[model samples]
Target: MKSIIKKIFLLLPLVLAWTACNDYPIDEDGLLITTRSECYVSSFELLGTDQRSVIVDVATVDTVAQEIHAEVNFGTDLHALWPQFTLVTDAKLEPKVTGFVDFSDLDNPRQWTVVSGNRKVRKTYTVYLTVQEP
Candidate 1:
């Protein structure tokens, strides 16, 4: 009985070590690309002169990285008006942050400008943005 008890204790650690490393491979330096369309479009307004504010919520996912960066993809009309839009990600502010697109002038408007005429308008639309590991 004493010999049996001593052998059992010796085998316990070996059994645990073998079981701990099942058939799982470790992957730490893997680059993952994820897409999300769940971001909410809250507001869009024309800025003073040649800029527009597009407010949109940042996507939240359980597997997303802690410090995420995004790139904006505007639609044909909106994109034409302002080809470049600024992106900001802040938790405290609604819609996270405002994207700035330039649409300051009409007659003298740059080559790519949406026709809004003289009316100050605010339109809301879900923008397709790209978030990737950078």
Candidate 2:
């Protein structure tokens, strides 16, 4: 009985290590195939007209509702050049916007095409930004 107990104790580490290993497959090019995540903008920040950088206070992603909410500082003071906003996403997006965003119209929503790392999945996200004027 003591020998059996010792064997069980010796095998416990092997069992635990096996259970903790993830079975992600790597391609011939040594790229992880299953580590890619869904495409979505994770965060957004803007350099306001006053030359102050401020992060969008409410950039939230609602996957269940398939929508994104963003807020920008749009006081009456910021009426000259449009504040340049930067967006970072989970995955690379195609047809990327090269220049700064011109926030002239405050109503229309913008769209982007998000492509997965494997190029097998594509998703669209509609970004709606609201101006918080006070």
The candidate scoring highest on TM-score is: 2
Task: Pull out the clashing pairs in model 2.
Answer: none
| The best candidate in terms of lDDT | 2
Ten residues in sequence with the least summed lDDT for candidate 1: 112-121
TM-score of each: 0.25, 0.52
Supply candidate 1's per-residue lDDT for 2. Answer: 100
Q: lDDT tens string, model 2, 77-110?
A: 3233333223233355555655455554657666
Give the clashing pairs for model 1.
49-104, 50-103, 50-104
Clashes of each: 3, 0
Which runs of model 2 end up more than 4 angstroms from their true locations? 1-37, 49-56, 76-90
After best superposition, candidate 1 residue 125: deviation in angstroms? Answer: 22
